[model samples]
Target: MSTVLFWFRNDLRLHDQPALHAALTSGATHLLPVVCLPAPDERTPWCFARVGPHRRAFTAAALRGLQQQTTVLGNPLLICQAPPAAALPQLAQAVGATTVVCEDIAAPYEQAEIAALRAAGLQVRTVWHSSLLHPADMPWPASDLPGVFTSFRQKVERAGITPAAPLPAPAQLLPPLDVPAPVLQAVGAEQGAAAIQPPAPPQGSDARSSFPYGTPGCDGSEGAVLAHLAQYLARKLPHSYKDTRNGLTGLDYSSKLSPWLATGALSPRQIYADLKAFERNHGANDGTYWLWFELLWRDYFRLLHLQYGAGLYRARGLSELPLAQHNQRGFERWCQGETGEPLVDAAMRELAATGYLSNRLRQVVASYLIYDLRGDWRAGAAWFESQLVDYDVYSNQANWLYIAGRGTDPRGGRRFNPTKQAQDHDADGSYRRLWGTA
Candidate 1:
């Protein structure tokens, strides 16, 4: 029987999984689905463990949830502790497969992984489905995308562009390709995910943290995702999201959807579909409209990656700006929330504690690192990648560049005055007090 190995990257869920669907329809008789966990001890150049505890807990939950679904479908997910370049070739050989199908990530490191697999003599088919709208459906070619987010959003709106409907989870995945235990052992594969140990099943033990992921509705599982979205819409929360989105310390203020989106546990299309249904049922308003606007911004960052591939990851992004000198001491202090800036410190503390942060605070802290502390934006980006449970590479890189005046930002760069920001967003000081940064 012919086999096709389906590699799970960031896109982890079954619902709205076009890539997985591609593998199912590829006519292979046996399918081996696998996800190579980042090497358990991988370190970023910043001399830190790349995946922090909270992101690990959330991602582990996602893997387990994915494993449970595939198991019920009669195909099991194989979790590997080695890198894809090392494990995939072995798995392919074990199953007698020469083909791999997975999600397309625009980032440099991810693209390199695909290259390595191809180098190893595997025919890799990458399907791009991470964004709300596909590149092909855009009003203008993504390659010639308007250099500005506002213009891009305007053009998309002028064309009335909307994401196509999301796909349902396949009722039955192709039967699992049976790999002998010796082969699995050689590659350090954990069948049915029995070997993976998430720090805590759902979350860390911090109660004061905004995202309380350990709480019943907040874990990274698909079951929790569906329930979270259902309850979010059932409460009619989207209608008031824009107004309350800036709140510093509560889950109710934001959609709290990024973690799921980042982990690929939830689909952006699923969110857009539900938001539209909400508007049709209750009529449209600015609050409901803003959520869609935010989704469009998410798409804008993805398209930018297509427009400029490795350039976005460079020290100075798309612009000719000189690299900002990284302040080693200042960055270390900032990461520890010891920068002595009350609002910024509080936000950093919150991020370290919960693996989540508000969008406003993210921009503020990024600006503080870039403009105030004179720190390298890349270092800040790496710190976020290491800490954020909701870290999406596209948005994170684009944002750091935007603040550092290195990307296509028309204003050159964005700098939020943290003092004024504190007065504006946290005048009551309750948020700072909550994080012990007051």
Candidate 2:
């Protein structure tokens, strides 16, 4: 009987999981669902823990949800600690599996993992289902994608390119092979066994939080995200999204879907699909259209990663100019929300406390770091990677590079005047009062 190893990376949820569906329909007599946990102490080049406590907690919750769902489907998830390159080949060998299938990731480090698996003589098959639209469905090749967001958006809109409907989760997965506990334990030991802990109970909602991921019924699980989405739409929140999205506080200010989207617990196409239904039922408005617009921006960043590869991670970024010198002290202050700028400090404190920041505040703090602090943009990006519960590689890097004048921005870098931003977005001082001393 044929056996296949289905490695789960960022795409954690079973619903709308094309890769998972493909693995089930591949006719393999036995299938194993596996999640490779990152080393708890993994540190980045900037000496910051690559995965902070908040993100770790959020990821654990998502995995637990996935485990429960997979168990219900009769194929329990196998949790492992080694990186994909180290763990996958050993597991496949132990189980005598012939094929390894997973979702294709676009980031540099993740691409390296796939390369390592192929090098180990494993027949790896990857499905590109992470984005709203598949790369093949684009009007142009990723290599030839427009450099600017506006140009890309215009071309895609002109071509009338719509995302393919998402695939439903499989009803019944092939039962797991009876690999012995000793063999599994040996493989795990060779790769290092990283313990999976249950996520801590949420800290309850802060009325000042735009994203209350910590609130009850709003934890990082796929079920929580889907329920939250339903509640938002049920209340017709999308109708006011465009106008309220810039607000400094309040849960209704934005969709707050980034956490789920980042973890792949919620698929972009799934979001797009629900959005279209809402527009059909409620009649489309600017708010609804803006949500689609934002999704397109997400797609654009993913495409950028596909186009640039390692270039996106470099100090010089995509531009020919060299970035400013790294200022460790300035960056440290920024990370601690101690930059002495009230607005930036508040935003930073909010991120440090809640692992989330509004889209407007993200830009505001990013601009402050790159322009006002005159710090290396990469340092700030790494800090975000360390702190944000919803950090996505493409969007985080692309945004920092854009703000640093090293990306596709035609006008070069963006520098937001903190005083002006305070006046415009937080005119009432309520947001500052909440996070000022934090």
Candidate 3:
């Protein structure tokens, strides 16, 4: 009986999971699935005061969901709290596994870990999953990638980009591999470890959380995705998506799929397909189409990171715009949600309280931090790193740079007037009352 190890990185679900399906279908009788929780580097912005409790709570919730799914499917997910470079190889050796399978991650940390594993003489296989549309499926050669999204979209449309249908969950999970768990006290969490629960749903959840914890299997499965989309679309809410997308308060205004997408509970392709179906069922309009637009934006950010890996991580900034003047006091105020602008302060407070902010507020706050407060965009990005349940390295970093005039936005820089924005988005002062006055 051959043993194969399946390492779960960001892709946590069983459905539409190409790598997991491959691992189970590889004719290996003994299969091991592992989840690793890496320790935070105290020096990194994400480690400092940046990573807030809200996103952490959300991650813990999703992990619990994954564990339950894995258990029922046969191989219980063994949790480790060590860096991937250390934990994965150890697991492979313990199980006498011939090969380790996982989804390919283009992020720097993921790339480095994979390199380390290969260097250690382990046969590692990686599959690209998560994107609604795979890069390989995109028409243009990655090297010839368009400088802007419009070109990429046009090229893909011209070439007729078609998404591969999501793979089904393995009907029979391979028998569990017998392996000793590694000692991972330094990294904090151990196998079957529980996360620290938050006081509330989370900042974003509170902003839009009519749906609370439903059942045990509600977090990381396609079933959950179907449930959410069905209820949301059934209400015909997507028809108002464009109008309410920028709203700061209430559930119906936002799609609230970030947490699921971030943890692989839902795939981008799943969302795309659902939107197409909704359009057909409920009349295609700007609202129905906006959902696809948002997914494209998500894909655009992912591609940006793939297209410019290390550059996105540099302190000099991604777009490398004119280094804005730094104001430490202003930066602090912004993070603390005390910017004196009710809208900015409310958004920051909401983030502090729940670890989520509206997309509209995210742009507003980023603009104020960079242009009005004259703070470095890197600092704003770092702040977001600390917060945001849906914080993907590519999306958050690239977005901050875009607002600060450092990234791909041809508009150069966006300077938002906090007052005007508050008046425009929260005219009734309802959002203001919820988070408190600046």
Full candidate order by TM-score, most accurate first? 1, 2, 3
TM-score of model 1 relative to the true fold?
0.98
* Model 3 lDDT at residue 341: 84
Instruction: For candidate 2, list the clashing residue pairs, or say none.
Output: none
lDDT of 1 by residue, 1-438 (tens): 899999999998999999999999999998999998886578998898888877877888888889989999999888887789989999899889999999999999999999999999999999999999999999778688999888999999999888999999999988886788877776777633554565434365577877888776787888899899999999999989889999888779999999999999999999999888888898888888899889888999999999899989888688888878889999999999999999999999999888989999999999999888999899999999999988899999998888888989889999999989999999999888988888
TM-score for each candidate, following the candidate numbering? 0.98, 0.96, 0.90
lDDT of 1 at 105: 95
Q: List the residue pairs that clash in candidate 3.
A: 50-386, 51-386, 52-386, 132-269, 203-354, 319-406
Give the per-residue lDDT digits (tens) of candidate 2, residues 58-100.
Answer: 7777887888899999998888876778778888988889689
Q: Top lDDT: which candidate number?
A: 1
lDDT of 2 at 314: 81
Question: CA shift at 389, candidate 2, in angstroms?
Answer: 1.0
Better of 1 and 2 by lDDT: 1
lDDT of each: 0.89, 0.85, 0.73
Candidate 1 stretches greater than 4 Å from native: 191-195, 198-202
RMSD of 1: 1.4
Answer with 1 or 3, whichever has the higher lDDT.
1
- State each model's C-alpha RMSD to the native: 1.4, 2.0, 3.0
Q: Clash totals for all models, in order?
A: 0, 0, 6
